[model samples]
Target: MNGPTRRGDLFDDVDGARRFTGPTTGDERRMLIDVLRAQRSTLRLKCSGLGPELSLRSAEPSALSLLGLVRHLADVERRWFRQVLAGQDAPPLFSSTTDPDGDFDGATDDPQVVAAAWEAWRTEVAFAEQFVTGAPGLDIEGEDSWRGTVSLRWVLIHMIEEYARHNGHADLLRERIDGAIGL
Candidate 1:
């Protein structure tokens, strides 16, 4: 693998790049958010600069692509943060109960699709951050009808795990698209 991949001209230096960084020192909440942020950044870095067509193309035999991952993550963020945690009735960002895999199935080569995926992902991330920031503590509970009550800490850890797992798929998908690899 190449030494930390870089997006040419888009970032000035390693510091400016969207690379993962663990928390140096902080409380559990701060550390959790830091880890989650790093994972999110890793996903963005993995998807950067591959044009729209390549972004949508699945690695043969598997119906998975970076574009699909982006849309899927957006849906996940909206589901967990906005709907379950914030108790908002936000509709699914890219999928529905009828067509549950719409996020991946509907991923297309159009640049608009890629742009929309990123927009929705960023929007959900912002809303999640805002909600977490305003919450009293990590121990605060949220009602998930299917999963019963869950705490903010559980959600944060789950989000981190979600990103980490998808990022692994992204690593393979990205490598298949272009030879780029590494954190």
Candidate 2:
């Protein structure tokens, strides 16, 4: 397949990292989904090159790693989309009541672990997408014990915020792992 093009300082479509050219005319749902997809793509780009070993390497003294972030995002996706939104009985993919931080703490330099994280993340994302696609509208409500009734719009916004925040951490982690940095 053809590779990415470098135009000036920007690398167009490099490593599957699509630039986020905000939607100007779409409806609210479309715009929100587009923005969320862009953020997800940014995270993928940030974690692209490093293998499992490097993926598990903490940028600082803490247990924050690229693989851990992937796993954590997967859990977040499942919680909000499948559990909270769709009302599915989805349990945590990596974390649990006994080991709540397992997603991050269990991250390791194993290829299997890295692969599983990606798999889980992709699976949850697909489920989320399907849930959103089938929803009647953004106003549809979901039950959450902690937050009580929540609209799909609220969930989408929260997810976007969540991804944006973690993507910032991914940027720092990627920079520390290597000198690579970009949009």
Candidate closest to the true structure, highest lDDT: 2
Candidate 2, 11-104: lDDT as tens digits: 2345455458778685999998888888888888888767865455554578888888999999999999999888899999899999998999
Model 2 CA deviation exceeding 4 Å by range: 1-17, 59-61
TM-scores of the models, in the order given = 0.87, 0.88
Candidate 1 residue lDDT tens string, 1-183: 668845532322464253545667868988888889888988888877777754555556666889999999999999899999899999897889899889888888898888899899999999999998898999988899788999999999999999999999887777766667676
Q: Which window of 10 residues has the lowest lDDT sum in candidate 2?
A: 6-15
The lDDT values for all models are: 0.83, 0.84
lDDT for 73 in candidate 2 is 96
